[model samples]
Target: MSVNNIHEWDKGEYNITTDIKKIDRTAVHSYLTRSTWAKGIDFETVSYSIDNSLNFGLFHREEQIGFARLITDHATFAYLCDVYVLEEYQGRKLSNFLMSCIHEHPVFSKVRRLMLFTLTAPWLYAKYGYEPVNQQNYAWTILRKDMYL
Candidate 1:
């Protein structure tokens, strides 16, 4: 995918791209390992996951500064997860830009629901049409954790 096609959301400094080849898993692994929310991630496993996912990575001068993943069936449900921006690259609004690309993508546009879980940054996602769902009503089961590992 061409970075030029990505819509500039929240200023034009960031270039969002869905092509996972542009992702630097090493850099992302370093960032995730340092993040409190992602301390459990295994870089080798993450590298494999990114290699196989319908994921998007945000770039600033060839660096993998931000990332988000889409878990989807190409018809119905899509869960957005592992959204992160590097510490040095934060405050540049790349998350919003990356999200805009995902939301606007042809595949995601047809999805019935987009779900995400965040321990922090609720306000940031709230502005992008994400709201808290009553967990009591929407129960989730983890079908496979070992597969990713």
Candidate 2:
């Protein structure tokens, strides 16, 4: 599949899609502002980020219930972030399906390295072959925690 093609997957009534137009920016911004890591983040910043990244949206019918994004060069590296499923939708294994779509997307087909920093749900990621960056030199980050506040 072409990297420019919109990718989609279905599970019962839910679906995951890589169509940027399907992402609900207001819902994403609302969830992120309440999240510990991105608390107080502004809409413009969120909008810009969404515009540039490869975003995945999980939906129940037409309502957006979850989201994730990859910042990538679409070949050598990708950083996964902003992954979440709404609290009301938590028990359905949608996250698993969402991750599956990300891995199967064309943008990630030639990725030599995929990275993510998660303060929660490491088990969820582990199920998909994501491992802790065990050695110190594997990553160096300049985190601006709560920067928007």
Candidate 3:
């Protein structure tokens, strides 16, 4: 089916399955490259990571158009990352739909503290209750390369 036809699905049109079986690595690489924030990611590395990470892909007629992933321990903290919608498919609120899926997914629902960072689209993320954190007030330490490497 064409994207246009899929886009016309009622709010509940296509089934939002959590199975990542249909994920398109090529499309994901394209989207990540377009995302700009993912500049240094090697496609092979990204493919490997996606294969192992807790991730989701939004499909319209079996074509992956949007993607997101979470880093979590399944109990305490979850960090959302690499959320992206293909440029051609933007403005259709697919990102929001994808987020809703992630929020309602069984594996992610119990996460206590969810965090994400974005250089753009703060408004979109804020609509989902994410806020900028004050780094200075937070207790954290940065490790220098000499210490760990």
Best candidate, TM-score: 2
* Cα lDDT tens digits for candidate 1, 16-99: 677666678888787776666566578887897677666777887666688888888879888888888877877876777777
lDDT of 3 by residue, 15-84 (tens): 3444546568888887776565676456886788687767777777667777888878878888899998
Off by over 4 Å in 3: 1-16, 139-149
Q: Rank the candidates by TM-score, best first.
A: 2, 1, 3
Best-to-worst order by lDDT is 2, 1, 3
Better of 1 and 3 by lDDT: 1
Which candidate tops lDDT? 2
Q: What TM-score would you give candidate 1 relative to the actual structure? A: 0.81
Question: Model 2, range 10-107, lDDT digits (tens) per residue?
Answer: 89999888889889999999999998779999999999999999999999999999999999988799999999999999988888889989989877
Please give me the total number of clashing residue pairs in predicted model 1: 0
Off by over 4 Å in 2: 1-4
Output the worst ten-in-a-row residue range by lDDT, candidate 2.
Answer: 1-10
- Clash totals for all candidate models: 0, 0, 0
**All models: lDDT?**
0.74, 0.91, 0.70
